[model samples]
Target: MPRIPRTKSKTGLYHVMIRGNEKKNIFRDSEDKDRFLEILYYKRQNGEFTLLAFCLMDNHVHLAIGEGTNDIAKVMKKITVSYVYYFNKKYKRVGHLFQDRFKSQVIESDSYLLSLIRYIHYNPIKSGLVNTVGEYRWSSYNSYITEKSNFPNLIDKQIIFMMLSNDPQKAKQLFIDYMSKETQENFMDLTAEENVIDEKAARLLYMNMLEEKKYKFIDPIPLNILQEVVSQLQAVTGLSIRQIAFITGINKNKVSRILRKHSKLQGD
Candidate 1:
């Protein structure tokens, strides 16, 4: 099938995601992640784009960018190409490192932009890599809240802060409050399924349900609760058993059995 053309953003602001090929780890170590950031900073200095926010994960990356001298596509090409060359050379590997084209959603409103930033910052926590956004070192969260920025030139925080308040201190406080609040915000991601829910959305639903029941999602949930979760996930997401298991950390065979029992009960 021919690929659909990306919708041009009138505001020139976008939330972009790039994943590693075959769901492989893009950054094998700290050096790779740092090098990717270095490339990003270089691009920023060159007037490529306004980097509002960024989160680097093991197999993927999320970026909130505003257009500069070039369009989003051109900017992504420059960044990804540069990094691919560096990565392949350093790792002694070849071929495409990134999976197909980078995925992106247009950011036209300030509210959605803030939500996107929070979502990006919370990626590490959502993936169980950390307990909180601040605990993660690979994202731009610190740049927004810290009194002194380690990479001052990397993130364009003034635009975001100004949106929050005229006073810098007040804006920082507001940002903290906004991020601290637990939300059910969802956005475009790499693992989206056509006509069905994405992985992130599914995970958010599970977490919300668990939270409402006063059950910590990170803890071992009861078998009955797992069954309910699996059934709901299957019905709402239309995702496979493996996908459900991956999302909930349940065994594939158990997820299937849970679904079977639910189906039998519904039929009766």
Candidate 2:
């Protein structure tokens, strides 16, 4: 089937998300985050896109960007390509870093725009990274409240603030209130909605083994049971042979042999 076209933002504003493939950790450390921010700042200059708000999570990212001289796709392409190169080179890995087709929701209304900004800023809090929004170090939350961020990268806060009120102090207070209000669409809930983990078979198989006095389908597992246990565990948990060996106290080569047999039978 053909792909559906992306919705255009009338106000030239879009709420965008890009995630790691298979929900893998994208920002492994503070250095990675800083490197990504540097890329964003450099790319922002090239693309001329206005960075409204952003939050960098461990496995994914949320960005609120205003339409600039370049199209959103092109801007994202530049960022993704450059960052993936840097990331792969640093980690000594390859292939796609981000999932295909970055998800986006158009910001058409004043209310939705305001709400979306708050949601993006509060992502770290929703993920339980910190109790309060002010405590999170990776989000643009501070830039909105403070004069300037400690980082070299900058956020365009004037547009959102000016929308609230002409009076600077009152606008700041209003923004604070709006940001701190009770929220429903948090980072955790949204990511969970998108991530569909396949654990049904694993759960059923584990339960059946437990019925037979097998604690975890390991330790003196007969040849008959070895295939079943290893197969189900691989399907359910996506564990590597080494991990299974560690968990089961079985030799790594033995675990590999069982896994190989299971794959061969399935292939046939």
> For residue 175, what is the lDDT in candidate 1?
87
Q: For residues 1-268, could you state the per-residue lDDT of candidate 2 as single tens digits? A: 7776776777788778988988888889999998888888877776569898889999888888887888888888888888899999999998988877787766654545666677787787767889888788888888888866655246778888898889988888888877886555322234443422222344345446644656432123477676787677778788777555433434578778898898899899
Candidate 1 lands at a TM-score of: 0.72
Expressed as tens digits, the lDDT of each residue in 231-265 for candidate 1 is 88789878888667645655567788999999999
Q: In lDDT terms, how accurate is model 1?
A: 0.82
**TM-score of each model, paired residue for residue:** 0.72, 0.68
Per-candidate Cα lDDT values, in order, are 0.82, 0.72
Model 1 weakest lDDT span, ten residues long: 191-200
What local lDDT does model 1 show for residue 28?
97
Candidate 2 lowest-lDDT run of ten:
192-201
